[model samples]
Structures are given as structure tokens and as C-alpha cells.
Target: MSNAADLRAKSTDQLNEQLLDLKKEQFNLRFQKASGQLENTARVRQVRREIASVKTILGERSRTA
Candidate 1:
């Protein structure tokens, strides 16, 4: 995973793309949880953090723009 600085350095478009990917992964994780096939429950927390990271970068970029 990239650091906050690396994330912040990404352009808005890149951040958006990353956010979309993260969201898709989050959805898959949720589906696995529902199906009782999720092996690592900790993945939920990690993905949540990744989502938040992308959001933070996007929000910061928007404010600056």
C-alpha cells in the first residue's frame, strides 16, 4: 500500500480511479462475508482504511483545487 504522501501526490483522476477500485474490492469483501467465505475478517478493516485513504486524498485535492 502506498503512503499518505504517495496518495496525495496522485492527480484527482488517479485518486478517483483508485477510489473506484477500492469500492469494488469493498463490495466483493462484503459479498464474501455474506457468503461465509471470508477467511480473514481483518481484511474488512484494512479495506475500510484503504477507502478512507482514497477519500482523504480526494477531499484534500478538491479543497486545494
Candidate 2:
């Protein structure tokens, strides 16, 4: 997991790309859970939080821009 400071330091374009990748991962995790193939139950929570964090950061940047 990346720290808020690290995410804030990244450029908007980079952050957007990372956000896209994270969303893809979130989708896969959901599928894994539905199929009963998910091994790390904790990962679902982690991904959700990470997605939230990235969105929050993006919002903050946009508001300040």
C-alpha cells in the first residue's frame, strides 16, 4: 500500500493511470470473491480503501487546481 504523501507527490496523469489500474484490480477481486476463489479476504478491504484514498487525493487536487 502506498502512503498518502507518495500518492500526492505523483503527477495527475500518473495518479489517473494508477487509479485505472487499481479499479481493474478491484474488479478482479470482486470476481474472485464471487467465484469462491479468493484466498486473501483481507485484500478486498485493502483494495477498497486504496481506491478510496486515490479518489480522495484526486478530488483534493482537483479542488485546489
How high is the lDDT of residue 50 in model 2?
Answer: 88
lDDT against the true structure, per candidate, is 0.87, 0.92
- Using all chains and alpha carbons, the TM-scores for the candidates as numbered come to 0.89, 0.95
Best candidate (score: lDDT): 2
Candidate 1 residue lDDT tens string, 1-65: 77898987888888889889889988999999999999989988988998898898787767987
lDDT of 2 by residue, 1-65 (tens): 99999998999899899989989998999999999999999988998888898999999988999
* TM-score of candidate 2 to 2 decimals: 0.95
Give the lDDT of residue 33 in candidate 1: 96
Clashing pairs in 2: none
Show where candidate 1 strays beyond 4 Å: none
lDDT of 2: 0.92
